[model samples]
Target: MTEDMKMDTVVALLRDQPDPINVLYAVSLMGLTKGLWKVSGAGSAGVTRAFGEDIWRLIKIGSTLLKADQDTSNPQKAMEFYDSYLIGRFNVADSMDYDVTDDSIEITVKNCRAHHYTDYLEENDVPRSVGCPLALGCAAMMEEVTGDPFIVDSIESKDGNSKIVLKKF
Candidate 1:
């Protein structure tokens, strides 16, 4: 099938599913597939780490598509897109505190699923590979939508969280 037709098919499938089912299919499946890949071959751990980054890239791209019409260049609008589209759709963070001023937007995530997953992995003696680089997709998406330069600092804390700052380049 053509690319447009393929995309339409996927969209139709997702649109027909319940919201929770869509979340589980799109979000949980990414993590589950990565986990499975990590155990499938002798060198699969490295491949899984790279795949994690690609998976996040897809998520960010999907978010941009969802907010295609919003004026994301405005810091406030970008914040709205992040909150309304990303967080609202994914429900991945326990708390997402944000500040949007005339010049920039600062987002701090607390009690995120990745943080909890890292904790779980640690408890089970599984190696942790996903890191701030996985957030490249998010920063890139915000930059594209907002016409800003973005940076994500992976805070070295017990919880796996990052502080993302977006400002005009």
Candidate 2:
């Protein structure tokens, strides 16, 4: 297929699914691609893992691009980024709640897809700390965009829900 046809296929798939499903679909595709590359000896396992993680970092940065377009220091911008950008892209926007303080933002993902995805991995003996990179990438992107230190204050994914607290470093 031509590049345009491939893009059209991707667009169609995304449009047909809900955002959370899209996120999961994207994860599935990434896994399949990585697994195939490993089987084909396209790259070493470490290299492939790094490549996949770098791509995810870029995606996380891209998701926070809207925040860069706005005044990052604004509390409302922070809230919008949390609600619309971070949670929104995960297809959990409706299920997340956040509070914006003067120097911190706390968010609770009542039903995080990543948490469930991690559970699925653990059940199958896939040793991966799935949520940290995504969270840290977002924090890194936010810090870069806002010129303010941002750190993951706490992340609890073992429980039924994923709760993340981002605070100024």
Candidate 3:
């Protein structure tokens, strides 16, 4: 497709709200900015993961990490890993719509850094500690900034370099 055509499509998709928040992508760490947006962190393509984050304050902490990648491991970068990389940074998104299903509350997050994820199985304790220091640090900063209780939904890896597509709630 032509550049204009592609942009037009993107604009249209962004404007079209799937749920309270909807996201879709074919790779390149695209975030659901309205519809789908490409994140610069990706080397080639991008992907996204859904969320059931119960703590709103922690959500802000994760966003702070994305804003600062290399500098996230500072002492202020939370005292944990999962909280930094997964909860604080990867789950960075505003204007969320909560989907209360029979099992979980679905919140859509697009263009999340899958590789940086580490909160898959962490203890419910403070002072984030996943593995990556930078990621953890970033999560710490996230808590300092956003004061929300953030949790991870899923950690998706590219596996072998394929396009990423996200589902809306």
What would the TM-scores of all predictions be? 0.45, 0.47, 0.19
lDDT of 2: 0.52
Evaluated at residue 81, the lDDT of candidate 2 is 56
Best of the two (1, 3) by TM-score: 1
Candidate 2 weakest lDDT stretch, 10 residues:
122-131
Q: After superposition, how far is residue 84 of candidate 1 from its true place, in Å?
A: 1.9
**Model 2 ranges with Cα > 4 A deviation:** 1-75, 86-90, 120-130, 158-160
Cα lDDT tens digits, model 3, 109-152, are 33333322222111111111222122232323344334532332
Best by TM-score: 2
Q: Using TM-score as the measure, what is the rank order of every candidate, best first?
A: 2, 1, 3
Q: Residue-wise lDDT of candidate 2 within 59-107, one digit each (tens)?
A: 5477657444433566556456545655555564337676766566666
lDDT, residue 29, model 3? 20
After superposition, candidate 3 runs with Cα above 4 Å error: 1-135, 159-169
What is the C-alpha lDDT profile of model 1 across 1-169, one tens digit per residue? 3556434534543554456665465545445544664566425444544544474455557767775544466656655665555466766666667777654556677756544444333333343333333244445545656565554433333544756554544
Clashing pairs in 2: none
Model 1 / residue 38 / CA error / Å = 15
